[model samples]
Target: MSTIARTPTDDATRADRTWTLDPDRALPADPAVRPIAREIYAETKALPLVSMHGHVPVEWFAEDRPFPNPADLIVVPDHYLVRMLVSQGVPNELLGVPAAPGSGVVAETDPRAIWRRFCAGWKHFRGTATRFWLETELVEIFGVTLRPAEDTADAIFDQVARAIADDAFRPRALLDRFDIEVLATTDPAWSTLEHHAALAADGYGDRVVPTFRPDPVVLLDSATWGQDVERLGEAAGEDVSSYRGYLAALRTQRLRFKAAGARATDHGHLATDTTPLTDAEAAGIYGAALAGTLGPGDADAFAGHMLFQMAAMSAEDGLVMQLHPGVLRDHDRGRHAVFGPDTGFDIPVVTEYTRALRPMLEAFGHHAGFRVVLFTVDEDAFSRELAPLAGVYPSVRLGAPWWFLDAPDAMRRFREAVTETAGFSNMSGFVDDTRAFCSIPARHDLARRVDAGYLARLVAEHRLDLDEALDTAVDLAYRLPLAAYATR
Candidate 1:
């Protein structure tokens, strides 16, 4: 494997370049801070990345196909890329987004056109973490020095296209090059898992696995909930029309996922409200939901009830339950009407966990077998509500700052706010919840660097020794998440 070299450029030319990662650029030249950060970075830099939760497709590993172009690999599938392009007045269809009704715009199929448009809007990502990650990927992975602008778009595109055609740049090869030991992709309960099975049978079981996400069954108000429930029933060999049969069917599907290498179950809901309703009330709600007559309040109650039921099921089945709540998905109805879900239209809403989770926690918070990891988009609740909850409840652990809060400043603020109360162990470490595959290593590298910088502050303040901080860095980078999500 030959290393790709960057073409030497003059200082003026380098200054104009926007998306390259120079070795010197990452260095902190401050005499005092540079050495301390360097030492901390060295200790954790080479640690294998642990991707407990992400949105990568299993077919990428199963088929091992060479990516066709930079646009297909980075633009079409990424909500970040699409959102940024939209903000710059670039039509989504022009970037290959599927056209919706009433929008007569056509998508651009040529890779060069998409790349040109995307580069022209590069300024939209200025000062954002997306820019940071993209630059790191271009430099470290693609070996490009010129920034992605209109002038250099064709050059960078041709270079990346050639590099991708190389055998070393294949998906599996990139996974090994990224030093990712294990990566778990989130799959809905109705998914067939055939791709995962093929990958496992083909001898990649140790590296890629599936995570069970049963949101369709829990969120009964969704358009396809009835169909999903019926499919789940078929998969589990249970009649899901009845409330008890539904729970049984869910358990069966979860167990099947566990056998297929699922170690955790992910829940994405509007809020974290949980309830342990009486059997009669639970049955009534379930029947209404099954009949497609559930009201707004009834839907909330059913979701809360399912949370408790899922916890109880986890107690028995040993799949770690992860609750990521407070996202108002597709808040812009117009965007949804056109682009559909996950088009970067989701927004964070204020969430209340104290009273919302009281009933459920009072029931299973102390249970030894049950483990619930709570993640919130509401930053205000980090120290006040979430930290205290995780600090007390034996089954509760805090998930890392996610989605809109996964940036460098957000991560730094999270450590500062929660470390004093919940400490590091009560947190579930880091997970890059992204759909972009090339950005995985870059995201992990940024997290490790920010964590090391935070630890350096602690060491400088004499609150933690250098040795202990080094161990904490390693755990935060590699061990804690793997242990937290690993099947007990």
Candidate 2:
């Protein structure tokens, strides 16, 4: 490594002044490798985003309203930002995060105060992917050059507020500004998709679509399971007083999702188990669930059996199946009670996939109509299970490193782990996977840079030609997700 002598003045200047993002922020650090990485990155950087899987609210696009103040828009709702501060003993209420109904916690209502809290705790986000995305949003989207700190917080906030006040900053405007070709919002199976249909009527049907999420109904042990099941039956216009009716309701709902331009079905169960239950066993479990007297292990067994059934439904209906498992959501019971869900106490445990998914794979692995993209927070499953499974199964494709593992190094590790076995063809392109709308471009940019660096290393080692690497970068950045989640 070349030694570049630094002075104390440089350190002082960097510490206190406004900063600009480096053009080559996340490129490979190697002197020889970086230039190649930059070239690959430049080619893919401006490509229209293909967000085939995400959690952005459909109303944002449907209403097309200007976003709220900076804090409400960026600070309060982002679980990534909220969790880091909470980890440092900052109460969620102190950041304007509302308590659950009857939790009796009065949240901070002042947007500027919440923003200041975020800025004051900014150092806690150092070296995290959240920091990268936040910084990018601040500088690129809102045009804030000032660093996020206590002294600069108000200045930065004012700049962002002024920027978002423009008509150009509205949700639908940003969809075009962000060059988002296809944005998929996660929707419950019971949803009427009124917002999606509204967007469709406004001619955004092809660009903004919904992905069917059936977690609340499938994970049968939830306290609201009965109500959620009833809602599902109502949505599908099916009588779900029996197990067969429940199945029909789900199938009907999936078809409705497809009719609304949905291309995929999303599952976030705690495990990847997909063992099919016998007809009698499944019916008995359904009856118990309906009666609110389910036996031990019934919920887990039913969830698994439902996953198997989901694959069969996918085979018939052609909704790309997306599964990201092994998250223990709302890990802190007290925090969950106060904050409901997605205030981020989700933790990942060991997730086994080979045996867990064997039953589903055996039935649909070679089916032409079936496609499943497997994602996990457990990196151990990457090389050991995911790569090998995707290598052989035509229906299975490896999802991008997601959730807790979506950082730069983690993404690089994912590429290293699976590329050798499954190769690029069996990998789904990047998915932003955020509820934070402005962070979409930032997240996708980070993924592209990390991928560019990974491919540059391959090129530097003479394993992949520069031309081939360039094409693969475009595939990962633009084309792959389109193909992987294609409705047709």
Candidate 3:
């Protein structure tokens, strides 16, 4: 069997491979809206990026290393692109996924061949957000003018390889080029924050920060929970043998993360359930979790109670709390066992927040110092639950349409659904929420055009005047996220 994927025709020559992108691709097409959209996009398009939440590793900035190659830099570590290619029958091994941690299995396949395989299957991404981001990286970042295809893959790869060798294309240089003013990384409570310290020591502290994420400790059944708690104890220099000690240790870690420049805490779970247990109930569950004798429902009960605890802590410590729930992680058991978490199989499930979050919302909805930004993957919840929650709660802000729903059409739908209830001011603005570093600008650019188009439609409808539309567009793209995730 052949290793490379094949497209219908590989005969297209350089002259025939015309894939030029229009400067106004995602802008509004209606005559009434186009003018207004263009005006709004012009002002907000060049604003500095505030990446308040993302998965990009700080070590990339700390080490300031050159990206190894084109395929590794662009293809691997991106679940969106990998899932699409995998659906088309491409194996992860062929896509440069390391066979083992610190293993050189990726070197077994030639990088150029991997690029050709991806190019050959480029049709799989034709209308996807992945295509938009990849095309942007190719043309705008690497200066490549040709469309990806079997015929042009090698040439495009060579062009990108040359660009990667430039000192200007190194991680730090690209951070400046990307104009990333403030970037937040997802880190656990136990993280040494060594990379963050390194950047601060190097005078880059103002630019990059970590977000506290404590899922492992919160989820009772996570295989590493007991071990992670030990590490947390070590990090906090506090004993975690009792329920109160555990809480105190957690608080200690949160303070440490805040001192390390974390402005928010991120939580992801299988459900949106935020119900709180009474103190005695919570202490009993914590004891069971530590003893490894927790019942089937105990894990979820404990997790839900911890969500309330986290929000309470946020109120006390003044860190914005971010919740993105309703994902059934590692839907494919086989892939998860082999490749580990975030391996592109975390599928979305229907979740209810109105009843689930009542306990926490009732307690903290109007707390003076508390802020909760809620994100959802289920579109049905946007107007039905999330928007209405943000509409009334002084402490709540609607997170952007997240993960699976962050695409163009979904983004437009999000604006329409949530704006009527929460309005632009109650929205968290655009969050790339990405690990693919090169796609950050492209993601933000797409969000800006979508927001402009949404506002332009409002202007055309005369529901909003032109000047106000322009202001709302800029706030949605720039000001809102800055204010929402601001360090408290």
Candidate 4:
């Protein structure tokens, strides 16, 4: 920790601020293990980032424009920040959340006012990982030493704005500045990948790749399902009006995605069910869904069947499959009406994976060339189901603690739950799944510190030697994710 004092400012509230982000902030709190944890953290602190799975927009890189302002850059769009503020009774419109289709609403338009609101709410984020990421970006990336508070909000915003306007702080420049190795973006299956193709033609294909997200095209209950099918058909040049043609279109889309530097297929479904249906059964359901006459359970059944077929396709094509299921998006309908989706209203319910994924696992869990990485919002599944499943199935690996669980305590609990059963090798490494670009380094830095502390405890307990723990720390921070999404 540095003893550097805050720069002298006219704002009396922050004039004497001694807030500093300690290098070992998230390490083991126990003095006995701190040294070893520090040692392990030092070895990998400067390693390049591997964003094997993330939600950052590809247009940021393709257009390569300067970030608009501090509020949009940090405050308004991040769900974590928005959610915490809303929990404290702040209106969504105050933070600029966009309204849904039927609700007529206009959010706060003043950037400085939004920044003040966020800064005023900084204390609410105390002891949260969001605070860590925000503070790190302010101090480390923007070189702003002033603390975030009402008095210092404008000063800090101005400091960030100066950095934003600089040629050195542009999107592509920061990707290089942050030393990201390979950043994979989530894209729709029917996407033209125009931004990706542009980036590739600009000669950054190996650095920035796409992950095929087929949920929009396959999830039939949505009002836009017909349009999604039409888009898929257009992309694949196949008649997706029928089940056979739909499968062929999906296969063709996956091939296009792979050709454009994709190495993984991503699924964000409501459940982990991967049960397959007989060909006639699947065809009948698909026809009904298209004809708008499907039974209540038929859409879900067809989705599960599609997942089974997707596993089969992965087995054939060698692209890793990622399943992040069981999230209740837009939990509050009233809030959702005004905020649309992804405005920090998602909640996790109890999830069962063992029985849910049996059909798909039974079929392809033993496949030699296939691989699956599973993520959950349900932490109970970590020890009881996830680790045990990944332990036995050659195809399955446990993804990092994600969503609401991606915090210091949850990360420690994750290692404790999964390592004893599946061991470290069956784990996928850290992924900073954020649309907030600057938080990537902060999130990864936190993950490394947490993992280093976990490994240090193992070393101190004599469960692992110093060398092995160090190796495991590096693997968890860097190597494992690369191998998990490595090109076929």
CA lDDT scores, all candidates in order: 0.83, 0.91, 0.87, 0.88
lDDT for residue 138 in candidate 2, whole number 0-100? 83
Q: Can you give the lDDT of residue 161 in candidate 1? A: 94
Best by TM-score: 2
lDDT of 3 by residue, 69-96 (tens): 9988888878898889889998777887
Candidate 3 segments whose C-alpha is farther than 4 A from its true place = 1-18, 100-109
Per-residue lDDT over 266-344 for candidate 1, one digit per residue giving the tens place of the 0 to 100 score: 9999988887788899899888887767866888888888888888888888899999999999877776767666763
> Each candidate: how many clashes?
0, 0, 0, 0
Ranking by TM-score: 2, 4, 3, 1
Quantify how close model 2 is to the true structure by its C-alpha RMSD in Å: 2.4
- Per-residue lDDT tens digits for candidate 4, residues 35-148, read 999999998899999998888899989999999999888887688998999899888988877666567777888898999999999889988989888988888999888788
Candidate 1 global lDDT:
0.83
TM-score of 2: 0.97
Q: Order the candidate numbers by lDDT, best to worst.
A: 2, 4, 3, 1
RMSD of each: 3.2, 2.4, 3.9, 2.0
Ten-residue region with minimum lDDT total, candidate 3: 1-10
